[model samples]
Target chain A: MKILAAVSRSTVARVLNCIQVLVPKPHVAVVSLDEEAALASKAMGVEFIGGPLPEKIYAIDEFKEYDVGIAALDNDSINISVVKALRSIGIPLVISLLNNSANRDLLVKEGADYVIDIDSYVSQNIAASLSMDKWVYVKPLSIVNLTLAVVRLARRSILGVKLGELKSALRSKSIHLMAIDRLGKVISDDSVELNAGDIILLTGIESEVYEASMDVEKLFRRHEETLARSFAESLRASTRPYG
Target chain B: MVFALKSRGKVSLIIYLATEKGVRNVKHIYKSIEDSISVVDTYIVYYGLGAFKQLMDIPAFHSEPPYCRGKAILSGVNLVTSPVIVVINGDTSCFSIDSISNAVAKVLSGETLLHLSKPQTNTDFTNVYRSFLQDILGELGITQSMLYPSYSIIVGLRKFFTTTPYSMWSIEQLAAINLREEALVVENNSCIDSTIDYVKGFEKTFVKDLARKAVEIALQRNTISRNRAEEYLKRIEAA
Candidate 1:
């Protein structure tokens, strides 16, 4: 695709790097009035369209031939003008960069097709990545709104339950027991004995899976605690002389 | 988990957000899908904002500018490594998880595209417009019972999306073009495009309840950050 990027020298590297990843073999032409910007574009072997703001963008004779145009100038007014010029001439797509988030509506009104604000865009992505461990990170996990969670059985009572017995219980909650990690190995046997410390991998809606995990943990812990209390009571009764 | 296991780093889900209304719609979509966050591999939520920061404070949404729906769909399909891609307009909301699952199943089961068609839900004028659309498609030698291309929820294969040139044209125009062969239509989904629709739509059974359920699930799963999800629910209450 042939794309025209109207950007300052500072943003050239980042823009080009993003284009390389996103677009497959884009024929990018860098447009800037700055000689330094032009030199950078030239060094990168990009087609350089040189001149001032809106005027230089308007001067491109073959504007319609370009598939998409990008206006990434740091100055909002200049970027707005450049985007406006591209749209007025019927560029198929015109995307502009925003320094200030406030100019988003104005740019869209001025005929820019898409607007991207750098700060919020970058920070949001970083934040999402940092918070990844708490949830699933599959490439398409949230598309269908499914998550993967691995829960370990901590108490012995619940661990005695066989996978066959638990299948119907899990199915009732719409949770699928995907794999069983016995010691260090992954097993898929339905008759596999339940053992404490075994990790069970589950896939289902987040809420349901979490609920199932909580229920399993609570049932096991409560059973074990009750069993211990009853044994102590029996011993106390046996030690009484009147009995 | 085995079924959920992805080969290599292949993306299993692609979410392209059409951001004409802003990022609130994007947040709404994410919130609605909170209950089923386990099946997704990765998601790309690009606001059709070219180079500007987003007006709405949805941090997880990426800001990618596209000229129109076509460009956004094409761009998203190109950028994401997923085999399945879902295109949703930010302004439209209120689709059931079952509807989404059904659509995804259809795509994975060999349907080229699934169009979430809520026929006859709009006004008389829109119905007439849809009939006109059917006539236009007829003239183009495309014979279909219904020609209204519902843009609320579109599910299809990434390859199918990339090969089909559905961009350049509006939803109706793309429908008239009739580019794909294995497209399926799903019905009963609803969208709130305007204030009137919002009011009208909510007057229906369980609309508010569904929103409440979505908010609750969103909070429980941390699908969106707690603060953002709560803030959104608060706005709805105040409204």
Candidate 2:
């Protein structure tokens, strides 16, 4: 669909570059109140408009310009204003950036088509990384998937057994062990014994995954907490004023 | 609507000083203004030391010395001219500096600052709560979430208890205690111990009443008519 994105210059450039890598060259229009942005977007093979906002808004009307108008501007007020102006013209699919949670109900009440909270999205990913077990930080998408997490095992731990033994132990739960990653590299063969920091990627439903991961997480939590506490203590001691 | 404070017939310059965290986005905003408003003059003042350094390095930007604090710098600018001085958070991931600047410009020009409501982040909650309090105190609207004393109170408590030997009280705990203490001080006048407590108690009541007044003002200003606002008030009362 033809998309008209109103954003700051750098963001527009970054978004355009990201879109270029993901989708085929699409009919995209970058509308900004800055000339440099228009030039930059034009360089990236997107349509650019550099004029007064109302004039630019009117200019888009001549062409079967855009189906979705994304007002990803940083300011909540401006995003809402742009959305309101677009909605006034009967534009479909008005997406906006809603930063503050208090404004969500108001934005919805005002008829915003879609509101994306980028901060919440990033924070959720960060929280997921901290909460999950045996997950890998997928560099490209920054998505923490189950496959990349490290599953900790103690020397005398019940799961200290080899991969085959652990698989057998987890068999009652019908959990499928997909792959094991150690120090960032995935091990191909399943015969290797599970050691400390050996993360086993498992595929299962919510209950199965929770049961399996919770066991590992509980075992590791104490050590992790101890290490964290000690590290914090050391940091504090180092920063203390020396008389 | 464009209130030109200067009689020099020159376009008034509105300098927006953003934190270093927001410099990259603010530069785009500067460029957008240059493109859109052919007559008006504009400059950007970056607040954070790091942001100031970055702006100094950029050949395009005419850098001024870093402003130590965002509000202080904004107030300083207000002293010189009445051009809209926009201040935004450096760490904001959602919007660019230019968009905020544009919005501020609109507000200064007497246009409505229309904002869409979304879910509040921890930062948003802190900011909104603080602004809500400050607005009640009849202060100029403060937008940045970090500037609120409540957030600092929480951070101070967290650091003091968790990282330092101050105590086991987290910032959240301190905030709750402070809030409860203020509430109790307002409710029971007998517990007033110090001048600070009395001031805080008065401020709390004033802010609460001001918030109620603000809601009334918002209702009047809202697109919904007086009848609708009254209906809303009735529904709220019924609930």
Best by TM-score, which number?
Answer: 2
> Mind giving the per-residue lDDT tens digits that candidate 2 earns over A145-236?
22222343434233334556555556676555654444767666557755655556655554566676565455456546666798899998
lDDT of 1 by residue, B55-90 (tens): 443323233333344454554444344566655555
RMSD of each: 21.8, 22.8
Model 1 chain B worst lDDT window (10 residues): B1-10
Number of backbone clashes in candidate 2: 21
Report the error of model 2 at residue B206, Å: 22
List TM-scores for all candidates, in order.
0.35, 0.36
Interface RMSD of each: 10.2, 14.5
In order, the TM-score of chain B in each prediction is: 0.55, 0.34
* First chain TM-score, candidate 1: 0.51
